[model samples]
Target: MALTTALNAASVYGAMSRLANRAQSVQTQAGGSGESGGLDFGNMLRDQVKSVVAQGNASEAKQAGLMAGKADLVDVVTAVSETEVALDTMVSVRDRVISAYEEIMRMPI
Candidate 1:
Protein backbone atom coordinates (compact mmCIF):
# COMPACT_ATOMS: atom_id res chain seq x y z
CA MET A 1 0.00 0.00 0.00
CA ALA A 2 2.83 2.38 0.82
CA LEU A 3 4.55 1.65 -2.48
CA THR A 4 1.34 2.19 -4.38
CA THR A 5 0.77 5.52 -2.69
CA ALA A 6 4.33 6.57 -3.42
CA LEU A 7 3.99 5.71 -7.08
CA ASN A 8 0.72 7.58 -7.32
CA ALA A 9 2.26 10.68 -5.78
CA ALA A 10 5.24 10.46 -8.09
CA SER A 11 3.02 10.16 -11.15
CA VAL A 12 0.98 13.19 -10.10
CA TYR A 13 4.12 15.26 -9.54
CA GLY A 14 5.56 14.16 -12.87
CA ALA A 15 2.38 15.24 -14.62
CA MET A 16 2.45 18.57 -12.81
CA SER A 17 6.07 19.21 -13.80
CA ARG A 18 5.31 18.38 -17.44
CA LEU A 19 2.47 20.88 -17.43
CA ALA A 20 4.69 23.50 -15.82
CA ASN A 21 7.41 22.91 -18.41
CA ARG A 22 4.92 23.31 -21.24
CA ALA A 23 3.70 26.59 -19.80
CA GLN A 24 7.27 27.80 -19.34
CA SER A 25 8.06 26.94 -22.96
CA VAL A 26 5.15 28.97 -24.20
CA GLN A 27 6.13 31.92 -22.01
CA THR A 28 9.71 31.75 -23.23
CA GLN A 29 8.64 31.77 -26.86
CA ALA A 30 6.37 34.71 -26.29
CA GLY A 31 9.08 36.71 -24.51
CA GLY A 32 11.91 35.64 -26.84
CA SER A 33 11.78 38.63 -29.16
CA GLY A 34 12.33 40.95 -26.20
CA GLU A 35 11.57 43.89 -28.51
CA SER A 36 7.88 44.37 -27.85
CA GLY A 37 7.71 42.36 -24.64
CA GLY A 38 8.05 41.93 -20.92
CA LEU A 39 6.35 39.55 -18.59
CA ASP A 40 2.91 40.69 -17.45
CA PHE A 41 2.25 39.20 -14.03
CA GLY A 42 -1.47 39.96 -14.25
CA ASN A 43 -1.85 38.18 -17.58
CA MET A 44 0.30 35.28 -16.45
CA LEU A 45 -1.77 34.72 -13.34
CA ARG A 46 -5.00 35.13 -15.30
CA ASP A 47 -3.90 32.56 -17.86
CA GLN A 48 -2.93 30.07 -15.14
CA VAL A 49 -6.32 30.59 -13.48
CA LYS A 50 -8.08 30.05 -16.80
CA SER A 51 -6.15 26.85 -17.43
CA VAL A 52 -7.08 25.50 -14.00
CA VAL A 53 -10.75 26.36 -14.56
CA ALA A 54 -10.68 24.66 -17.95
CA GLN A 55 -9.13 21.54 -16.44
CA GLY A 56 -11.84 21.50 -13.77
CA ASN A 57 -14.55 21.89 -16.41
CA ALA A 58 -13.08 19.11 -18.48
CA SER A 59 -12.93 16.81 -15.46
CA GLU A 60 -16.57 17.57 -14.66
CA ALA A 61 -17.55 16.86 -18.26
CA LYS A 62 -15.73 13.55 -18.15
CA GLN A 63 -17.53 12.62 -14.96
CA ALA A 64 -20.88 13.53 -16.53
CA GLY A 65 -20.11 11.46 -19.60
CA LEU A 66 -19.23 8.47 -17.46
CA MET A 67 -22.52 8.75 -15.63
CA ALA A 68 -24.34 8.98 -18.95
CA GLY A 69 -22.62 5.79 -20.20
CA LYS A 70 -20.68 7.68 -22.83
CA ALA A 71 -17.22 7.56 -21.29
CA ASP A 72 -14.80 5.04 -19.88
CA LEU A 73 -14.30 4.93 -16.14
CA VAL A 74 -10.54 4.95 -16.58
CA ASP A 75 -10.68 8.07 -18.73
CA VAL A 76 -12.84 9.90 -16.25
CA VAL A 77 -10.59 8.90 -13.41
CA THR A 78 -7.54 10.10 -15.29
CA ALA A 79 -9.17 13.45 -16.04
CA VAL A 80 -10.14 13.95 -12.44
CA SER A 81 -6.69 12.94 -11.23
CA GLU A 82 -5.02 15.37 -13.57
CA THR A 83 -7.27 18.17 -12.37
CA GLU A 84 -6.43 17.32 -8.79
CA VAL A 85 -2.71 17.46 -9.49
CA ALA A 86 -3.06 20.83 -11.20
CA LEU A 87 -4.97 22.20 -8.24
CA ASP A 88 -2.42 20.89 -5.77
CA THR A 89 0.43 22.46 -7.71
CA MET A 90 -1.35 25.82 -7.78
CA VAL A 91 -1.97 25.75 -4.05
CA SER A 92 1.65 24.89 -3.31
CA VAL A 93 2.83 27.78 -5.44
CA ARG A 94 0.40 30.17 -3.77
CA ASP A 95 1.59 29.15 -0.36
CA ARG A 96 5.25 29.67 -1.29
CA VAL A 97 4.54 33.08 -2.76
CA ILE A 98 2.63 34.17 0.30
CA SER A 99 5.42 32.98 2.55
CA ALA A 100 7.96 34.95 0.55
CA TYR A 101 5.80 38.07 0.72
CA GLU A 102 5.46 37.72 4.46
CA GLU A 103 9.19 37.28 4.89
CA ILE A 104 9.84 40.43 2.87
CA MET A 105 7.35 42.34 4.95
CA ARG A 106 9.24 41.38 8.10
CA MET A 107 12.61 42.51 6.78
CA PRO A 108 14.30 45.40 8.56
CA ILE A 109 14.81 47.40 5.36
Candidate 2:
Protein backbone atom coordinates (compact mmCIF):
# COMPACT_ATOMS: atom_id res chain seq x y z
CA MET A 1 0.00 0.00 0.00
CA ALA A 2 2.86 2.40 0.75
CA LEU A 3 4.56 1.55 -2.56
CA THR A 4 1.29 2.21 -4.44
CA THR A 5 0.89 5.58 -2.74
CA ALA A 6 4.46 6.59 -3.61
CA LEU A 7 3.93 5.57 -7.23
CA ASN A 8 0.74 7.63 -7.42
CA ALA A 9 2.49 10.66 -5.99
CA ALA A 10 5.30 10.35 -8.51
CA SER A 11 2.83 10.06 -11.36
CA VAL A 12 0.97 13.16 -10.21
CA TYR A 13 4.19 15.14 -9.98
CA GLY A 14 5.20 14.03 -13.47
CA ALA A 15 1.87 15.06 -14.88
CA MET A 16 2.11 18.50 -13.30
CA SER A 17 5.58 19.02 -14.74
CA ARG A 18 4.36 18.10 -18.22
CA LEU A 19 1.44 20.52 -17.89
CA ALA A 20 3.78 23.34 -16.85
CA ASN A 21 6.06 22.77 -19.84
CA ARG A 22 3.12 22.76 -22.23
CA ALA A 23 1.75 25.97 -20.70
CA GLN A 24 5.13 27.65 -21.16
CA SER A 25 5.21 26.62 -24.84
CA VAL A 26 1.73 28.04 -25.42
CA GLN A 27 2.58 31.29 -23.66
CA THR A 28 5.70 31.73 -25.74
CA GLN A 29 3.79 31.19 -28.98
CA ALA A 30 1.00 33.57 -28.03
CA GLY A 31 3.39 36.22 -26.75
CA GLY A 32 5.73 35.84 -29.76
CA SER A 33 8.96 36.14 -27.79
CA GLY A 34 10.64 34.01 -25.13
CA GLU A 35 12.47 36.90 -23.47
CA SER A 36 10.73 40.15 -24.47
CA GLY A 37 7.28 38.52 -24.46
CA GLY A 38 5.41 40.29 -27.30
CA LEU A 39 4.87 40.20 -31.04
CA ASP A 40 7.31 42.09 -33.31
CA PHE A 41 4.96 43.48 -35.94
CA GLY A 42 7.60 45.36 -37.93
CA ASN A 43 9.85 42.33 -38.24
CA MET A 44 6.91 40.15 -39.26
CA LEU A 45 5.80 42.62 -41.94
CA ARG A 46 9.31 42.94 -43.35
CA ASP A 47 9.67 39.18 -43.57
CA GLN A 48 6.32 38.87 -45.33
CA VAL A 49 7.21 41.59 -47.86
CA LYS A 50 10.55 39.93 -48.58
CA SER A 51 8.84 36.61 -49.28
CA VAL A 52 6.27 38.25 -51.56
CA VAL A 53 8.98 40.00 -53.54
CA ALA A 54 10.94 36.78 -53.93
CA GLN A 55 7.85 34.94 -55.16
CA GLY A 56 7.06 37.76 -57.62
CA ASN A 57 10.56 37.58 -59.06
CA ALA A 58 10.29 33.83 -59.53
CA SER A 59 6.94 34.24 -61.26
CA GLU A 60 8.36 36.92 -63.54
CA ALA A 61 11.17 34.57 -64.56
CA LYS A 62 8.67 31.83 -65.35
CA GLN A 63 6.64 34.26 -67.44
CA ALA A 64 9.73 35.28 -69.37
CA GLY A 65 10.44 31.65 -70.18
CA LEU A 66 6.91 31.26 -71.47
CA MET A 67 7.34 34.31 -73.69
CA ALA A 68 10.34 32.58 -75.26
CA GLY A 69 8.08 29.58 -76.01
CA LYS A 70 10.07 27.42 -73.60
CA ALA A 71 7.00 27.26 -71.31
CA ASP A 72 3.24 27.06 -71.75
CA LEU A 73 1.39 30.26 -72.72
CA VAL A 74 -1.34 29.86 -70.09
CA ASP A 75 1.18 29.25 -67.32
CA VAL A 76 3.27 32.22 -68.39
CA VAL A 77 0.28 34.55 -68.52
CA THR A 78 -0.96 33.44 -65.12
CA ALA A 79 2.41 33.80 -63.43
CA VAL A 80 3.06 37.23 -64.95
CA SER A 81 -0.41 38.42 -64.02
CA GLU A 82 -0.05 37.29 -60.45
CA THR A 83 3.34 38.95 -60.13
CA GLU A 84 1.97 42.20 -61.53
CA VAL A 85 -0.88 42.18 -59.02
CA ALA A 86 1.44 41.50 -56.10
CA LEU A 87 3.83 44.25 -57.12
CA ASP A 88 0.98 46.71 -57.61
CA THR A 89 -0.38 45.91 -54.19
CA MET A 90 3.01 46.41 -52.58
CA VAL A 91 3.48 49.75 -54.37
CA SER A 92 0.05 50.97 -53.29
CA VAL A 93 0.71 50.04 -49.69
CA ARG A 94 4.02 51.87 -49.79
CA ASP A 95 2.38 54.96 -51.25
CA ARG A 96 -0.31 54.94 -48.61
CA VAL A 97 2.18 54.57 -45.80
CA ILE A 98 4.29 57.40 -47.17
CA SER A 99 1.23 59.62 -47.45
CA ALA A 100 0.24 58.85 -43.90
CA TYR A 101 3.74 59.66 -42.67
CA GLU A 102 3.73 62.94 -44.52
CA GLU A 103 0.36 63.89 -43.13
CA ILE A 104 1.49 63.05 -39.62
CA MET A 105 4.59 65.15 -40.01
CA ARG A 106 2.55 68.09 -41.24
CA MET A 107 0.41 68.01 -38.09
CA PRO A 108 1.29 70.67 -35.48
CA ILE A 109 2.54 69.25 -32.23
Residue-wise lDDT of candidate 1 within 1-109, one digit each (tens)? Answer: 8457545644654565566567667768776524347776645754775677678767777877988999999998898789888878888977998999999999997
Off by over 4 Å in 1: 1-37
Candidate 2 — which residues are off by over 4 angstroms? 1-38, 67-69
Q: Candidate 1: worst 10 consecutive residues by lDDT?
A: 5-14
lDDT of 2: 0.61
What is candidate 2's lDDT per residue for 33-101, written digit by digit as tens?
A: 444567655445455465555655566567568668788878866865775576567668769989999
Backbone clashes counted, model 2: 0
Q: Pick the candidate with the highest TM-score.
A: 1
Error of 2 at 90 (Å): 0.5
Count residue pairs with overlapping backbones in model 1.
Answer: 0
Q: All candidates' lDDT scores? A: 0.72, 0.61
The TM-score that candidate 2 achieves is: 0.55
